[model samples]
Target: MSQRSFRRSIAIWLAALFAAYLALAYFAAPEFWTFRDRGFRTQHFEMVTHTPQGIPGDPINVGLVGTQKEVVHAFAVAGWDTADAVTLKTAIEIGESVLFDHPYPDAPVSRLLFDGRAQDLAFEKPVGAPAPRRDDGRVWETPCGGGGGRPRWGGSASFDRGVGLSHDTGAVTHHIGPDIDAERDFLMRDLATAGVLISTGDISGVGATSTGRNGGGDPYFTDGEAIVGILKQ
Candidate 1:
């Protein structure tokens, strides 16, 4: 073959190889990693919490790494009030707060079960007038431990949009806003601002969905990523 023709052929081969590399690096490799990571998350994380009746409750979108005391202190530093347990006195107080538009900084939140047990801790922050609208989260100490043997707490953070009846049981409840991802970020920001977070990263949750329904049958959406924060010791 002529030298010029051989050079042209070599150039063509190299160009084709470069195109294949680009496809693998930009498209195929990323897709493979995504699938693999999703499977890993599914196997490792409890993606959602459940209602007492075994109905699926909120998707867990937050996590923390610390001891029980450290977790509580982090939230306290963030100005979040520890939620009162549901009791006769607290229930009556919430009822009056809803009816009379009174400010109950620490209010009782509905119970949600994770790993077949109720949350270990709950916290809330009043949004404004109209006592029902608030930011609340429930944390459960998972069996998993984080770096340095610290316990990991799985959490579901959501914004209560308004008071309403449960679509499943027709009982009174608070409807949550649809954008749960925003609520997750909101909580993370609060913790970071409180100077309690040492570092933050993400883990997989329920997976991205535009049409997710909680136990209350309220429509919600999320990016399906849970933010995991390592709290200061």
Candidate 2:
């Protein structure tokens, strides 16, 4: 081919490549492209460390302890919330353990909390007695009033959030106003709880649902699911 023709061909190819790149940027999800395309390198890690001061979005680097100790791991926060992120990171640092019905593993998503929140690590050991420690005045339950300094919301037997406040605190602080539309929502939430999946609301009513709840029904929105989670922090 002539020199002029060869140069022209190269220019055309470059233009086409640039156009394709721009198209991908405009149409594709940035996260899907960058994270998924790069692949999970953390699978090659030996030990992982996540700091508390950092929020979930922060990037956490883990190191490998195997034969390929030379390579470092790159992990983006796959947490649903900071709590879940912390739990997943902790799980990695402590190795692995089993709980409920699922096998918690050490993959990016497995250890990551998409909602940035994870199952509250209330007790280190799940299917047994809690860690042997003196009650350090920290109330294991919350929203339960008069016991220490918490305000007594009231006794809830069968709450949608699954909080059975046995304490006679008040007439039930679920006073979010009894709206007719809330029935189905509450019922669905309660059903989720019975199946072992605690919604954001369930986490907030943590005080009632622990050892003290499960005998009766307290009907009220109490706090919104999303709201309950945020307040716990």
Candidate 3:
């Protein structure tokens, strides 16, 4: 081929590749593309949490549409124990659970802020009691106040497969698994099996094509469709 023709072909291919990239950037995850306009009430999703320093945390995967009492009852029926409030005794329990290889099913979770406060509710399902790692849990919060008789709560769920130091802060943090979507589904199934769910639905703008790191730099991913469920009293 002539030199001029070869260069022209290469240019065409590069243009095509660039166009494809642009298309993806525009049409892929709505959460990232339209991040600026996100509001908890209007948008389908929101950030999972924020760091103590106010950095963005994880992406919310699961949401609940019910009153506080209903939420507590649903999780109870699903065989999940409420996480103890963060206190000195609870802190010691978690430490012993890790060091002495004992089970603390109701271990207190580290604070993850939503609406400038820690989670309103937390629940956990122990895995192989006393095991060092691999436990399923969730942190839930009601970001918007219940007004006009509408009470809604939402948050993220993840499995702690291991525990390690944070890459960014060097503080100990839970190492969550990449397949966060599975954990979300697991919670739904548990609620359904217990006959506590009234209805289930999905909302958009939370899914992302690529995995993301949280404030602690733990990797996670989601379907972008927040699983929302209403519970019965």
Candidate 4:
């Protein structure tokens, strides 16, 4: 074959191969994975939590496949303190801590509801001043069971950026940062680093949202994926 003709044929073959690769990588593979994951998606319970007044709170962005004791131990190993329930004395302590720039490592967090009940467990990791920044996760015992019939704990992980007034009710509250997915990943990373996580996988949540507002009217965004960790047994 002529040199020019041979070169042209080779160029055409390379272009076709690249196009096929793109099709599989961007389209076919995603579709296949989605189909495979549909069964797992249906196992999730409530996608978001609600406030005392029934307003939608934060979206569930993390989960744990374990018993209550295992769940608590995992967070503890990850350097998170189980939050104290909001009460008169604890409330006053958090208020004082915030006002005086003190570190109340296990401060009380406002209650958020899932399945018409207050969170089964809540954990917090204070950052710098407890009032200005903190990592929080509110967990609920989900009806769905994981492998080996272990109870699943669905949770909403969020970062409290600062204390402020609630935009909806004018009540005092903590405003969360918008990128909740970052908080979710951060929590998972902490657990993994602490060797408390056996394995991690993603499930569907409130779907991808760029303009979601929680009960406090604080704006937030997420990739709509919840990471579920199987804690070390």
Given candidate 4, what's the lDDT at residue 151? Answer: 96
How well does model 1 score by local distance difference test? Answer: 0.86
Instruction: Give the per-residue lDDT digits (tens) of candidate 4, residues 116-231.
Output: 67899999999997555899999999788987899998899999999987776556689999999999999999999999988999999999999999978899999999999998
Candidate 2: minimum summed lDDT over ten consecutive residues — where? 67-76
* Higher-scoring candidate on TM-score, 1 or 3: 1
Best by lDDT: 1
Writing each residue's lDDT as its tens digit, candidate 3 over 1-233 gives 99999999999999998777555533443234235424433323345566554445666777787777888888888999888887888777878888888788887666776666667888888776552354445556565653345577877787877677665455556777788789889888899999998788887635573668775677777767778877775
RMSD of each: 21.3, 21.2, 14.6, 20.1
Q: Order of all candidates by TM-score, from best down to worst? A: 1, 4, 3, 2
Instruction: Give the Å error, residue 224, model 2.
Output: 26
List per-prediction Cα lDDT, in the order shown.
0.86, 0.23, 0.70, 0.85
TM-scores of all models?
0.80, 0.16, 0.73, 0.79
How many residue pairs clash (N, CA or C atoms closer than 3 angstroms) in each of the candidate models, in the order given?
A: 0, 21, 2, 0
TM-score of 4: 0.79
10 residues in a row with least lDDT, candidate 3? 25-34
Give per-residue CA lDDT, model 2, range 1-233, as digits (tens). 99999999999999998777555533343333344434333333211111111112111111011111111000111111111233546544423322233323221111211122221211111112211110100001222233234231111111122112212221111111222124324423332344322222322222211122111112222232211111110
Can you write out model 1's per-residue Cα lDDT over 1-233, one digit (the tens) per residue?
Answer: 99999999999999999788667644665454455433332334468876655556899999999999999999999999999878999988888988999889888898887766789999999998656999998999999999799999999999998898777655568999999999999999999999999999998889998999997889999999999999999
RMSD value for candidate 2: 21.2
